[model samples]
Target chain A: MPFEVYTFRSSGKRLFAGKNTPHFHAVYGIIAHKQTIMQDIQTEMRNRAKELLESKQAGLVVGFTLDEYGKPTPAFITDPDDVGRLVWNDDCVRSRHNLVGCLKRDEVRKLGKPAVVVNAAGKRAFNVLIAESQREPGDVVLIDMEPEPRDARFDERYAKLAMLDTMSREERFAFWKKEFTRCFKCYACRQVCPLCYCTQCIVDKNRPQRIDTSATLKGNFAWNITRAFHLAGRCVGCGACSAACPAGIDLDLLNLSLARAGETHFDGYRAGENPDTLPIIGTFSVEDKETFIR
Target chain B: MPQIITRQQLLALIDSLLEAGTKVATPVARGEKAFFQYLEKGDAPLIDPAVFPVNSTKEFFFPRHEILYTFERQGTEVLVTDARPFVAPQVVLGARPCDAAALPLMDRVFGWDFQDRFYQSRRENTTVVSLACAAPDAGCFCTSVDLSPETQAGADAELLPIDDDTFEVRVFTEKGRILFGGKTSESDKTGRTGAAPDRKFDAAQIRERLQTAFETPAFFSEAAVRCLGCGACTYVCPTCHCFDMVDEGSVDKGRKVKNWDSCQFALFTHHASGHNPRHDQGERQRQRVLHKFSIYPEKFGVLLCTGCGNCVRGCVDGLGIRPVLEEIAK
Candidate 1:
């Protein structure tokens, strides 16, 4: 009842329309529609995870669940009984590749248990591990994800990128300058990213301090550009970095712009599509499709 | 003296401050979350403080990045020029009470050895106008730390929204009195205050349990297992003041900048020879709690936390301090 003040409007009317009203019914209908879709996917995911955990097929099932704050967070369920805790929602936008990437470490590998996720990110991360010689194909188990609509929560992410694309060079500069001003160098983007799995991140090294950790205008520009450039062709486009950022920086745009450039210049070299495909920068082709290069 | 001011009068005060070349920071909605940013001249600030902002008012005081000094090579001579702290007079309007209370706790650390002029100057320059929180979130535990919605610890002035259009302004300091500036009219409702939410957690019980917490490694380890070791919790925290000084730009021509640092990171304690006293996640987690509850209270007689719950809200894994405190109390 303490939160009732939040619902009460300035005129003392409830913020939301009355439950019996058409407006309320319509809103409830939309919510119910979305919930039904979510429930369908979640039930299947939970059942599969439960089966895997119970059958000893996987040691852990990396999934999503609501935290105490009602925010979706990564859940590591080892017990079949705990599979009920797993959920599927728009907030679970993180690419599970990073979770799987942890298994490659010797400390985590010693646990001797496999992990499963119903997504492309986990599979893509596993492929990157294989590409890096950390693991071979079939070393990890990835269940085929159900047909879910592309998360619309990231529409603003793409829209911002599009808006930046339309802006003049000076306008673009000013836009990014304002955005980068919010950067705190928390490294949440790098930490959440599956591909940014360097044992010693360049920002962390101080002997030759590669990138400034301070979130100053010059320092942020340097650090952000370096981070985006590093993942040019390799980024999985999972939207994890932008999703995890507490600053709300539109980093997805940076990655997406680079991803588009990689696709255009490298003859549609989409990252995380095929495990065997040579990385755009990793291999040189005699029949390279760089006719635009003067 | 406590005074009454209409919502329009408050808005006009903010407008006048902006017109008079004073930087006014407020919680402005950007994208999905509201962050504390300096309001532009025309922008109307949000009246509801919304419990707490995504980013604390700490940014106005101790910025995430600050240039300490710049060095330039002038043909065999290195020229150094100190970067003075920006001390322009400013106002933080509609600051959450919990966030306002954190300023004094930060003042203790920044003023301890070498008086950090950057933090001290901002503290002196900025006048905080805090709005009493009407709706406390699930994660809020300000009452546990001896702070309430009406607790005016660090705020220059406090305002309680009586209804949609009026606010009861209570000036605590000379800075606040000057900011109000005779605009507030005398009204019958002078000393009236907002209703505070029920106490969320038992602070005394938690404090007692923490005294003997160090001996119990198992308790901390259990909590540490879920931690992703991300700096989200500390960076969003109101009182986490640890920082790292590094030279940005080239050795020939660049600046020495101080960046906010968190103990949650492995590198926070890593030495040149690869020796870390707080190696494990459990130890690191223990240090954070102990510092907030034990060390801070022992030194400053105030808990280091303001219970703003930004850490809880922004935590990547949802590792809230309330549950941890509850566990310790148990």
Candidate 2:
């Protein structure tokens, strides 16, 4: 009943070879082309497989090749020489869909059937495959996809958005006001938002009626602004709130504006990346930059 | 001339209106507790004009639990059906100035970016009749905020109690005028003498007091340690607008509903990866204050509070905002 993991890799001829292919080959294996290259790849995969097998790390190894149309072919090789062609490349293996597609091929499936462990990416590959056709945690599962970098930035657009650094106070206020005025207080933005989920809101507190309940222009303005400020640097820009608002308010603008300000004011700190990182207002650093503070 | 009824006569008129097929909702006493309830033809004994109700009029416009849309699936295919729309037109009577003032604030959020047809439809059809405060409570601080006891900013028709029984009705909008149906007389006088002499406090002095309180060293330090992190304050607040969206039932068939949410809960900022951004109560409390005092004022020209004192009355731990504001003002 334990979960099992399976790893897979491609064993096709190189249609295009570059830095990624070399990087991939360094970890997985080289394309089975010249005898020398094939021998080198075989030596590497064997060294890796031997290390795992000796340590009782992985249960199986599955290697594959591709057809002329870039589709996974039915040909596979467990032999170290053939397995040597399975190299890792960033560009070639960047997508999960591509790896999954190649693994589902008939020839690859056969190789994967008995594999209790898979080393799909070649570098630090581990996944468990159970005997009952299930998956386990320790089983090494591999696919022909590029491995994530240590400090990779997921969205480059956020970087670009963070670079604008030229918005004035008036411009920022106007932008936020236009967006906030459209709020309907349906709380869809707050509900779908991962950041705004509090058990009891201060606005709802009756002890002093901190915020009014009768949804008005003034009240909505206060509520929306307060929400945006609380999420100032902490928003991950998931766009969940904007997507969920029944009022069609462009809340992303408010969040992004603050995010942009946070970047401009503070050395471009992003939220949700480091759990240990304190909020912008929570901690004060001696080397903190304060050009934006008036 | 149309009848100028006393308080009892007005109640009779409300009963007659209910008898004539109009849905009338007013603040009614249910034992010790009072809430806005449906006023039937013979519920005269239940109507209370003393204080603002425990519950808000938001339910009449937007119910706590409403089915936004329903989905039914046959095999792998799914069909989504919109829920029944809001159509009933009702009257909200005996609304306080703060509660009445809250309607426009709610409208901003609902009408901004997206138009909430359900809330809009109910709002467009309903008439709000508010009552002026005869005597203000120590906890009542609407005057300190952006409103006053007699402010009729959001009410369709404002009723000022002149004596023990009679009231001078002031119609503020066309809707209010229409609701009177040419029965009520109009007067040119801007101000009328009624109720207790209105206590006058300098808006500038109140603002100064608030400004001084915010500078007090204990304001943040005291609030940080005492708050138990419960949501009772936000839930009872006239302006709190946090909510949660949940899909009830099976994936094949279910309804997506939005329910009221509070920020005091630890899980409010919990991430899918088991990380919470606002993990501590102090941070949450700081967020509460900054949102109301600093951020809201910066975003909107007005402050978020109307000084209804609900939070003062509802706080279980005596960590009420008035003391906090007083500490801040000190």
Q: For all the predictions, what are the DockQ values?
A: 0.40, 0.01
Model 1, position B230, has a per-residue lDDT of 71
Estimate, for each residue in B152-179, the C-alpha lDDT of model 2 and write its tens digit: 7679987766556666677788887776
How displaced is residue A261 in candidate 2, in Å? Answer: 62
Tens digit per residue, CA lDDT, model 1, A168-188: 999989889988978887787
Q: Which stretches of candidate 2 lie over 4 Å from their true place?
A: A1-294, B1-4, B40-42, B45-49, B182-218
Best by TM-score: 1
Report clash pairs, candidate 1: none
lDDT tens digits, residue span A112-173, model 2: 33221112322211111121122233333442122322343534535544433466778766
Model 1 TM-score?
0.86
What fraction of the true interface does each of the listed models get right, in terms of native contacts kept?
0.56, 0.00
Worst 10 residues of 2 chain B by lDDT: B188-197
Best candidate according to DockQ: 1
